[model samples]
Target: MREARPLPQYLVQRYHGWRATAFVENRVWYRRLADDGQHPRAMVIACCDSRVHVTSIFGADTGEFFIHRNIANLVPPYAPDGEQHGTSAAVEYAVNTLKVAHIVVVGHTNCGGVQGCHAMCSGHAPELEEKSSFVGRWMDILRPGYERVTPLPPEQQIRELERQAVLISLENLMTFPFVKMAVESGNLSLHGVLHDIAEGMLEQYDHQAGGFAPIV
Candidate 1:
């Protein structure tokens, strides 16, 4: 095993500050949460982008959401091949164990992952095409999305691809038998949304509308 060093001074200081203020201010709530265990009502599958603050965006409090983040917020098709699947594991726990009523897939504008997919699909990103590149393989999940938006202008295609990320994840979530059963039996619902980072706006997917509409 590699020898590990302590946390950087800035992060350590920030943690201390949070411990002193936020933790102290909500000590009772924190303790109660610990004693009761979590009962979050929703499971949020979001991107690993630091700029997208899931809690802040939803104004969520502690234990309000069970969040799973990964590159591009991609959820691969359900495959029960005896292999490690972090995202699938999280989804299974959330739906079957936690019984969350809502599963929300959140994608954001100007997503680097989406951009990389566009580049790779357009045959521009050779580095990401390597078989050994984990990122390349992961972004492959969104290739269909890229293909869907190919006829559009460059800027429009990128924006639509971001929304497609959320849509694709929502579709993949249903590929899980448990998720499909839960939805079919009225125990769970799936949702998709795109967050416009610079504009501070959110557009939700409306099945009836067949596209994303701003959250009024």
Candidate 2:
């Protein structure tokens, strides 16, 4: 029988390496902010992708962005649906306690979650339904986006899916009363960012330019 420990031996070894690294670079940050608490300038809603870490992509220093990540970096609309809502709670804490000024819904290209959603929606991948996985429910968040791009070309459809996912998450941010009040009062602002992982490029939504612009 396997040891009842949560981590296997190799994982434990890698974690030990990470811990040693944490002791070096992260020590100063943990000392300064851990006792004082999280005071970040921005709150980033990012994906739980192995390649899309917000801290590393933006080169964030300690406590730079209060991050909330899920399968697809979703923020479900605020509702008393009798479910444990970790994302909503984190958003609330970021807005109410940390009082962060910016909330960025950071989406990325070549997202497998988005791909799964598109494949399921198009009805070509019926096998996805057999797994009884959270992928089904998580992909539901992209329903509105799916409806918007059904008739477009394959390339444009995928782009629309990714872009709309970010915009809808931005909309969901306003479902929280505190987030709404903060944005309305100019205490907070919202953004939709698209990160291209393969190209290692970052794009920011430029309202004036009417599209995404490369990070300068």
lDDT values, one for every candidate: 0.95, 0.84
lDDT of 1 by residue, 83-115 (tens): 999999999999989999999999999999999
lDDT per residue (tens digit) for residues 126-146 in model 2:
766655867777778887888
Task: State in Å the error of residue 69, model 2.
Answer: 1.0
Leading candidate by TM-score: 1
**Backbone clashes, each candidate:** 0, 0
Scored by Cα lDDT, where does model 2 land? 0.84
TM-score of each: 0.97, 0.87
Clashing residue pairs, backbone N/CA/C < 3 A, model 1: none
